[model samples]
Target: MLSSALKAYVNAIDDPYTIYMDTEQNSGFQEELKGSSDFEGIGAVISKKDYYIQIDEIIKGSPAFAAGLMMLDRVVMIGSGLTKGLDVNQAVSQIRGPK
Candidate 1:
């Protein structure tokens, strides 16, 4: 599951952005297969000025859908062992795979 802070970051944005997935050789593919095949769990690129946590487009079910996440929901934490920092690059890293 994604951290609350990361979720909040996604929920606070209100703008048209592109979500991308990293395709690195080291990334594990078996784990990604555990989730829905349709959604490869990729990274997103939201606008910087879009409040970062509260906006209209940020709402769930919208074009910028976050699968199970909702809009305006702050992401306060992530991962199990360590509280990893939440950023666009990090988000992309999580969803990316070996290409």
Candidate 2:
């Protein structure tokens, strides 16, 4: 469950669903899960001139968000590194830290 403050913050966004996940359980452990892999590399899509970067959405009160990262902020750079040639998976891997 999301805290009230977090919910409020999500509600303030243009796309709150971007931060929400479905928790409904269709069956017990016996059933295979669907759409689980969909969350693996999800990120905000930002377009600038003809380039884009996927920004991993950190938690509500995280330093990233506090620094101005929104649901879909154009992630032009990660730290001192530019996101120019990195693919979505590479970018996500970098943002998620070491494996």
Best by lDDT: 2
Task: State in Å the error of residue 24, model 2.
Answer: 18
Task: Give each model a TM-score.
Answer: 0.29, 0.41
Model 1: per-residue Cα lDDT over 1-99, one tens digit each: 344465456546733352222334114223333444554443222222232322112333333365544433443333442223445445444434443
Which 10-residue window of candidate 1 scores lowest in summed lDDT? 47-56
- Which parts of model 2 have CA positions greater than 4 angstroms off? 1-50, 55-58
RMSD of 1: 11.2
Tens-digit lDDT string for candidate 2 (19-81): 432232112111222334333322232222235674424444545556677755667787689
- Model 2 misses residue 28 by how many Å? 21
